[model samples]
Target chain A: MKYFRYKEEKIFRVLMLVSTLFIVLALAIIIFSILYKGLPMLSWEMISQTPKGGFYLGKEGGILNAIIGSFYLSVCSTLLALFVSLPLALFMNIYLKRYKFVLNTVRFFLDLLWGVPSIVYGAFGFIIMIHFGLRASLLAGIITVTLFIIPIMVRAMDEVFKTVPVGLYEASLSLGSTRSETAYRVFLRQCYPGIITAVLLAFGRGIGDAASVLFTTGFTDHIPVSLMQPTATLPLAIFFQLGAPIAEVQERAYAAAAILTFFILIISILARLSSGKFQRNKINF
Target chain B: MMLQNREIRRLRDRLNVSWMIVILAIVLFLPLLLGLGLFVQSGLLLKELSIWNVLFTSQWMPMSGKFGLLSFILSSLMVTVLSLLIACPVCLLTAIHLTQYAKRYVLNIMHPVIDILAGIPSVIYGVWGILAVVPLVSKYIAPLFGVQTSGYTLLAGAIVLAIMIIPFILNILIEVFRSIPTELTEASLALGATRWQTIKFVILRKGFPGIISALGLGISRAFGETIAVLMVVGNVAKIPTGIFQPGYPLPALIANNYGEMMSIPMYQSALMFSALVLFVIVMLFNLASRIAITKFETK
Candidate 1:
């Protein structure tokens, strides 16, 4: 019996090790397979110019249209989400700090919103577009994405707000500052790094999301001339290019995907680095 | 002058409060708005087909206005359940080991790795699915089973989804395991339990609710995921009879029918109805798991 128990223990331990190794191996394989297949074709021109004539046939022109469109879309959405969520976060943590029921209920709702899939947002955006007699354009995409990221940003900022010592709020209020002033100046001052991190994180999320914008942002080979015009995005660029029959187009699709991944990778690394770098600057209170 | 200054401050605070209320109201009501919008749009279909009819029928001929969704519903459930089956044990065991047994340095490295994995876009996961999993299914897994497939089988999708969701499920499990106070494990160990036995009896016993919550959230996430699954899952509108067969999930159906869905009558409404179904399902999964989470937190 002793030997059997020991054997069982050893076996399970091996199983755990193998499972963990499988995850690590899976990430490594995914990164390597994609990078190797696509990295060779990556170039400055590949990101610098819009698709020229017969672009899907693997002709001249880059994914510049997608790159710029994604930039505009995510940037606009992230900033919009920040403005919308900042007050919500501040209201919850600073203004209504003592109301546990209200706080919990709001947090729970936000969590629900966070769990909502992006595709539903796209569907809802479509409904709105139909109602407003609008077309799939950058404006529609940004509106949808802003709505999508608001919960995420609020939840992230709420986390930072919670970390704040109540003493800071108390001290600020005791100094004759209004609640709004304290909420804005004191919490904002302390949580700015975290707020910035959340914004960038949401931006990365918005940039990479294909499903939410799949319908709202109409496809175009040319760079968007206006928010009203249908615009290309990197995720959709990859989707459209990969769908083409030619191997060259498929290769560029891989390249576009690689570029998108590289953008996210840089963002995450920056998030990690900034969180650490900013830790020293944060006032402990 | 002091009274005037105080009065101005109070007025400013009042203005800020009202301004905030407007924004907060939007956040609070947005989900309801979305649900209402989707329902109203899908109401176009409900006007023609009963909800029960939509749920039960599987014909789905858009040309003739047949909008049966039974097959899509089943495929979504099948794929989500299968991916959960593939991902849960691995995530649970790995998280258990990392939190309970692994050295600290290993964890420091692993956390960021998990985050990066989670951060990879679903579209890229789709691309990788095409590059790696598709071929593997066709060449190796299918041959072993003596079946021929285009490599875009239900198994291919489940495999890709399992990998895509590993970090999501794993991250939550890690937090769950870590939150279980270490004293319980030490107490079990003092009673002459082996480390594995202690984990089995004490940690698992304590963390079971959390584990359920994590899996529930993971299911919700995997259930509604598009792009990746759509890219690989050979979007045939049929129930997959075998793991190697092609299937179309609801998210794939919603995503694929976008833009060009106008030429056919009831097609847009059908897709919108699927989104409504998806929204309600994801919401329920979230609601159930959140209750479990609250229970675990109280415990």
Candidate 2:
């Protein structure tokens, strides 16, 4: 029986090793396939020029409109989310510090929101837009994406703030600092690295999301100059291009995907670096 | 001067309290508001089709006024369950290895890979599925099984989703396993139990509730995943007879039809109803996970 159990342990260990290797293999395949298909099609014009007529028929064009639009949408939404999330994080860690029940309930709901599918947010956003007589414009997309990322930003920032020592708050208060003052001056300064990491995380989420903006952001070929105008995003660009019957257009989809992946990789690396810095700065008390 | 200072402090406190209330209110109530909005929007469909008929019937003809969602519901279930089946054992084993057996260098390489996996967007997975998984399955796996498909089947979606969800489940399980006391494992080992037995009877038992919650979270994620599943699933509005057959899930249904819903009568409402269904199902799973995690933590 002992020998049998030992053999079982060895077999299970091999199984675990295989599974781990499988995950790594999958990731490598995804990256390799994207680069192999995308690089040959990727060109300076593809990144600089807008699609012309019959672009979906493999006509000459670029995804510049989507590149610009994704940047605008993600940047605007990330900043908006930060404005709301920062104050909320401060409030939770400072003013409502004693109300553990309320804090947990809030965190629970935020988790639920985080878990919600982006497509449902699209539906909800569509309903709200219709009620307000709003069109599917950049503003609508920004709002929808903002709603999508607020929970993420707030939760991440909240976790960072939780790591802060209680004594620091008490010390500031004893030094005659107002709660608002201390939250803004002391806590915010201490957690800024974490806050930056959270922002990057939210930005990555915002830029990559296609479902939440599917209906809310009406697609267009031009870079949106006004918030009221429809904007194209990279994910949607990839989706539309991939759906084309033409093979060249499908290759363009690969190029678009490669661009998207590159953007996310950079953001992930930045987030990791900032988080490492955040850990170094974290108060140990 | 002292009185004036105290009054200023009082004013600041009041202002802070109000700000807290406002922020908390928005943070807590926005999701409920979104849920309520979806519910109200779906009322149009409820008015048109009896909720029972909408849920139970198999035929879904938007043009001819049939609005059944049973097939979509079933397809979603099949794909989610299949993906969970594919992912759970592998992720569980990987998590066990990470926490128990892997050396530091192995962990150093593995941790970043999992982190990178977690950060890859769903759309990239969709493109990868279309580029890689589809052809491989169609050309290789399907033929081996004598199942003919274009490769865009429920199985393809499940495979993509399983890969997508591995990091999500593994991350949670690793945390749970790490939290288990080391003494428990040592005690079992001292009793002359093999490592497998210790892991099975000691670590797994202690982490059982967390594992359940992790799976619950995985289910919620798999069920609600959109772009990747939509890209791979063949999007035929029918209950799949086999994993090799093409089928449409609810999220895919909404995504494929939402743009043209205005042209068909009651179509928009039906889409809204589908969104509501997805929302409720995901919310229930999320709540279950929260409850499970909380229960385990408190214990």
Candidate 3:
């Protein structure tokens, strides 16, 4: 009986071990697929050259235009979202909760937006952008992405703002500091690290997003000097280029995808690393 | 210096009230205002409003003027339901396994892996589905069904979405289970219940609401997802005849059709109407989940 129990336990443990290994294998497969398809043609010219009409597996295709457009859109949208979310979060922390029902309703909306599918947002953007007579322009894309980023920023900042002990606010109050003064100078200053994190997260979300960008950010092979013009993003470029019948276009898609993956990976790693550091520093200071 | 600081502080405090109000207004009201403004600006009500038929009809052809959201809505439901079916049970079991069965060392090792899974981009999951899963499905599963296949089916998309969302559900379940006072489990055992029975009666009950919320969120997440579905579901506009047949969901439809319909009012509104529909459904699901969490916490 004892021997049977031991053997049964061993089998179960092995099964669990194998399942965990499968998870690693799955992740490795994705990373390896991109690298295998992309790396052979990942030369300096491929990275630096301008976009061309005809596809080339070994030459001429570069993400320079896509990268510039993607970076511009992501940065602008993240900043816009931060600008929108920070004040609202600060307001919620400062004044809204005096009426609990109203505050809860506000939170309810924020949470709703947080879970909204990017596709639906894309639809909303389509309706409005078309109405504005904008045809897949960069401005349309940025504004669409801007709204998507806002809820994420607001939620993160709200939590960060809530953590600044009410006592701190009280102390500021007792010291004859006004609420606005304390909020802007003291509270905002204290939550600076978290706010920066919120911005980075928003940027990461914007840059990594493909669906929201598909319709609004009109795909152009050429880079735009103006935000009003349509431009291709890395994700959109990957989708359009890969979906083609041409093998060269497919190879370029893989390369663009690898680059996009690398950017997201870097951002994820940085966020994790910095948050860890912030936690340690918080304990110390 | 203290007097100067106090004066500045007083001035700042006086300035803050209106600023805070403005912030509140923007956060809570911006989307609603924008949506309403856009709706009015677009002249949706005065224009040819065929949204009702578009939403309910079976066919969606923008080029030919025949549009419907039936398949899109149904596909969205099917994908979400299938994903929840796979994800909910596995997540619940995984949570139980990690929280109750596994040793602390084993759990510590496993936790990071789950977190890493949660962190991976959905697009990466789609890529894996295209490369690894589709081939396997076509090679094995589709052959059984007597279908020639690429494996870019609804089943594959649902499975990938389920796998992507499982960690989220598991994480929430684990938190809920861990928070259950250990004494309740001990009491159940002390009262002569078996380990499984104790888990069923006590732990499961304790975690039920959290699990429900997790499932609701998972369903909502799966429902709204676009890129993964677009890539793997094959983007056929018709009602899917089989699991392997191409289908459209609201998100995929919007993504695929929105850009191409630059000049048409009906095309634009159909997409917006779809968006409005999806938004309302997601909002309801979110609200229910939040209420469930609050009710559970209060209990």
Candidate 4:
């Protein structure tokens, strides 16, 4: 009986091991397939050169415009979200403790906002922008992306701000600091890493978003230097052109997808590292 | 004189308040105001909207007079259900293995990859789906069902959607299993219950709420997904004939039509109507999930 039980235990462990292996295998397949199909065309000309009339991979058509537009849109949305969500975080920390009803309602709405589909936000943006006569412009896309980014940012920032030891706040006040001073000087300093994480996450969300931008940004072959003009980001480009039967266009989309994936991977890694560093920094302090 | 000065200071301190009110008003109230303002501005368009005729009817042709949300709603539900059917079991089992079985070092190495999965974009999922999963499914899976095998179908979209949501489900379930009190497991083991038996009886029961939340969020996510489904679901603006037929989800319909609608407010309003419908469904599911989880916690 003892030998049989041992065998059963070994088999169970091995089965669990195999299950874990399957997940790793899935990740490997995603990364390897993308790289295998995309890396061959990622040359210098592909990075810096301008698109010549039409799509060409391993030639003059670099994703310079798409990259620039993605950078611009991401920067705008992230900054807007940060501006809005950080203050909300600070307010949640500062007041609303006794106002449980209002506080809970706000919390619920924020959660709902976070969970609302990005595509819905796109529709909302489309209607509002069209009414304003900004049809398919970069401004519309930025606004759409902002709505999607804000809720998550607020949630992350709120969690981080709450975890900031209350003693830090009390101590600052006892040392003759004003409420604003204490918030900025002490609470902000402690929660900076979490804020950075929120920003990075929003940035990741912004760059890779396709559904929200489909109607808002419209489609343009040329990169626009101005925020008012329509522009194409990597995700939009990938979505629009990935289905192309032309081998060259499809190849360009693949390379662009790889670039987008690489960008996301870097942001996610940075978020983890910064958060980890913050924990260590706090421990040391 | 000194005593008089202290009294004055106390009175002044009692009367003066912090500017916390200003901060709260700016952060919380401003957005609410904006949302309200936008709603009011769009009220003209919404005034022409009828909840019954727009939402309940099954004909969605903005070009013609008929507008039916049935196909879009059905398609969204089909994708959500099928994707969850594929992902939930895998995720739950994976979570079980990770939380209940894996060594600490193994968990550490594996967790980041899961995070990477969550970080991957929907558009890339679309790209990958179109290139790989759709082709494989069209070739091997669809012909068995007597439907024309193409890269774009409900099955292909569901498969990609399942892959996209598995990480989310896994993340939640891991948290759920982690929260199961260790004493319950210990007590079960002391009574001669095997590990699998203990898991089946105790762990699964305790983690049921988390599991529900995981599935809820996963379904909500897959339902809301647009780009991936749009790219692969063959954009046929009709009801799917089977699991293999082409379909158009509500969000996808909104996406494919929103920019093209210029001649009519009805068209834009129809898109808004779809958005509102999607939003309400998502919000309802989220609220239900939260309430269920809370009830479970109380029990």
Candidate 5:
């Protein structure tokens, strides 16, 4: 019986090791495949020039339209989300600090919003656009993405705020500062690094999302010059390019994937570095 | 001058209170409003097609006005279930290894890799699936099973989805396992139980609720995943006869056809209806998981 039990334990350990290795293997496979297939097609032209006519059919031109559009969409939406999420997080953490029930309920709703898939947001945005008699455009995409990322931004910042010692807030209050003053002057200053990380996280999410913008951000070959105009984004560009029957167009899709991956990689690394710095500076008391 | 100063302080307090209320209200109600909007817009489709027909009928010929969602619904279910079957065990085992057995240095390397996996965009996964998994499966795995496909099969989507959701499930399970009191494991070991026995009997029982919740979240993710599954699922509007068959899950269906939806009669409504179905299903799973996690935490 003792020997049998020992064997079982060994088997379990081996299985666990294998599972962990499998995850590592999967990640390596995904990254390698993307780099291998996408690197050759990536170039300055792909990054700098808008697509010419019939770009999806393996013709001349580049994905500059998508590159700029994704940046504009993500940056605008992240800033917009920050505008709402910062106030909301502060309101909950500072103003409603004593109301545990209200805080939990608010967090619950935000959690629900966080779980909402981007495609549903896309459909909801589509409905709103139709109701307003609006066409798919950059503004529509921004609104949809802002909604999509607000929950993520708020929740991440809220977690950072929770880590902040209550003594800091009390110290400010004891100095005769108002609640808003304490939030901005004390909590915000302490949590800015974390806040930046959260914004980058949301930016990464916003920029990579394809489903939410599928209907609201109609595809366009040119860079959007106005909020009312439609814009192409990197994910949508990859999707469109991949769908083409031409081999060269498909290769361009891989190139687009590489670009998207590069952006996300930079954001993730930045988030990690900033969070580490934040941790070192974090107050214990 | 004292009275004027006092009045200014009171006005400022009121202004602060109002600002808080306004921001809180918007943040709190926006998701609810979006849910309601999806629900009401989906109702428009009921005017053209009965709910029973849409849910029960399998043929989804939107051109002839038959907007049956059964195939898509089933396809989504099949893909999600298959992926869960593939991912849950690996995720649970990985979480166990990380929380219970792995050394610190090993974890240091593994954690960032998982984070990077989570950070990767779905579109990249799509591109990778197309370039790698599809070809590999079509050329190798399918033939071994005597099934001939172009590699864009239901199984392919499930594999990609399983990969996409492993980190998610692992993260949740790791949190749950970390919360388990170490004394339970120590007690089991002290009672002459082997490590595997202790894990199977004590840790698994304790973390079962959380594991379920994690799987629920994973299912929700798989069901609603768009680009990766879209790229590999072959996008056929049919009830898949086998894992090797091409299928159209609802998200992919909406994504592929929404552009031309207005051109066809009742099509826009049908797509909206599909989105509503997906929204409700995903929301329910999320709510259940949240409730489960909260219950576990409170316990």
Candidate 6:
């Protein structure tokens, strides 16, 4: 068994180091270039005004419409996802305790749903919009994004629910609580940090994602006044801006990317910070 | 009266059970509804053309009503497979290094970096692809290969896709390596085997199923990635036999065309069919990976 294993091992070791270096460098270069290119174009007007006439021609308007639209889209979608996901998570972990096969099947399907790309969700959402005679608007986008993030929120909460001690459920039952009461009162109380973290995480994903809302949202130049109105978003804003033949518009795309990246970074950090802050109440296993 | 009170409490609990079950039913049926919606939406196109004609032909002129999808399908498969080929080795090796060899501080530094990479918007990646990868491929790599090409070639798309998936695949691989029991590696080293030999025989053997699952999942992700690939892949509806050639993937096809074509007679249906194809391919890959993961876990 004494083969060229030693040389093979060294080769793999070097390969690992090199590849890791490459990936890290790639990440660094990406962020660095975006910041470099975008910081110059960052202006008060850029975040404060809607696209005026000839905006894509490097004119005098900003992307405030997209900034606000992205906020509304993600916040609204995350809330909708919570309403759908909470009950589903609670049911899987509590009401279906004795139903092992059904539980596994449901869990598997959720996992599959998590892996389903946002683009397919977009397509399906379009179908629904057409069926309901709805236009591509903030409302349609929110519904689509909700469908997109439900599995994510549910799975994250499910992981947290699984960490809960079975004894905790037994203890609550022994103390004369109903299953729903135990689920919402006892388990939910204990799992709030996990639940919050999951929501914020899903929110982060929803905000940054473009494909799910690309067709459904139908970008507009102004902030949407209502759920049914079309609105702009940073991702779509960047996409449309970058496609222009003008150099200034292309650079503005980088600025929009930087803004989107900044929001995502803040969300990730907030998610971690919020989880840490609330974790003090978690019952130790 | 006390008995009645207790009965009411029990009945309220029963109501809760039914409410939960109703939510569960909706949750469970969602995937089915998505599949059905995609089918029915695309059924209009299928009704017009034979399934064989649509799936196998490559000519895709929507203005003339010829909706052959073979080129898009092949392009999607090629880009995804190529990206996986590029990503799998780097991610697997890096994961092994992180878990098996790197110091704790290295892992700590790398964690946020990986998360940030994962969390960054796909549009940023697409923008970066346009900013960096495209130029690099066109000016340097393509010239080196003696090919005159735009930067928006299949290889450029593959490079971006590979980079985009590093965090995803690496996280899975790291978990796989960590799950390999320390006892096996220790026993191998105690038997006078080198660290590399131990990893080659003990760790690799133990983690093989996990590796397969990770790669499978990575493929699923790479295939359905739309914006970044769409930005760099040139959106050409032709069979790409070379890496430097432009290619149009399924998701890209759907994304680029879905917005305004609803007014066209068969255009919306064709785009919907492309989405359906993307969904099915992703599902198959994900199912295979899930099965692999289950097998490894059950072992």
Q: Give the winner by lDDT.
A: 2
Question: Residue B61 CA error for candidate 3 (Å)?
Answer: 2.9
Model 6 chain B: weakest 10-residue lDDT segment is B256-265
lDDT for each residue of candidate 5 in A241-277, tens digit (9 for 90 to 100): 8888999999998888988888888998998898777
Model number with the top DockQ? 1
Off by over 4 Å in 4: A1-16, A56-60, A97-104, A278-285, B1-50, B143-148, B297-299
lDDT of 1: 0.90
Q: Please give, for residues B1-299, the per-residue lDDT of candidate 3 as tens digits.
A: 98898777677666666665776666577557545644553355226546567667888777786767898898888888877897776676667667777778878666656755665656656666776677777899888988888788888878778777777777777878887889999999899766666777899888888888878887778888877677787777777766777667788777777655657866666566666777767767877997887677667
- RMSD after Cα superposition, model 3: 3.6
Q: Give a tens-digit lDDT track for model 6, residues B202-221.
A: 88899999999999999999
Q: How close is every model to the real structure, measured as TM-score? A: 0.97, 0.96, 0.88, 0.88, 0.96, 0.96
Q: Candidate 4 vs candidate 5: which has greater lDDT? A: 5
* DockQ per candidate, 2 decimals: 0.80, 0.73, 0.43, 0.44, 0.73, 0.71
lDDT of 4 by residue, B165-260 (tens): 888778878877887789999999999978877887899987888789768878778888888778888878777868888888888887777656
What is the Cα-based TM-score of model 5? 0.96
True contacts kept of 4: 0.53
RMSD of each: 1.4, 1.8, 3.6, 4.3, 1.8, 2.0
**TM-score of chain B only, all predictions?**
0.96, 0.94, 0.90, 0.86, 0.94, 0.94
Q: For model 1, how does the per-residue alpha-carbon lDDT over A37-58 read when each residue is reduced to its tens digit?
A: 8899898889888888878788
Summed over model 6, clashes come to: 0
Q: How far does residue A251 in candidate 6 sit from its true spot (Å)?
A: 1.6
- Report the TM-score for the A-chain of model 4: 0.89
User: How far does residue A218 in candidate 2 sit from its true spot (Å)?
Assistant: 0.6
lDDT of 2 at B126: 98
Q: Comparing to the true complex, what docking class would candidate 1 get? A: high
**Candidate 2 lDDT, A113-223, residue by residue in tens:** 989999999998899888899999999999999999999899989998998888999999999888888888889988878899889989999999999999899999999
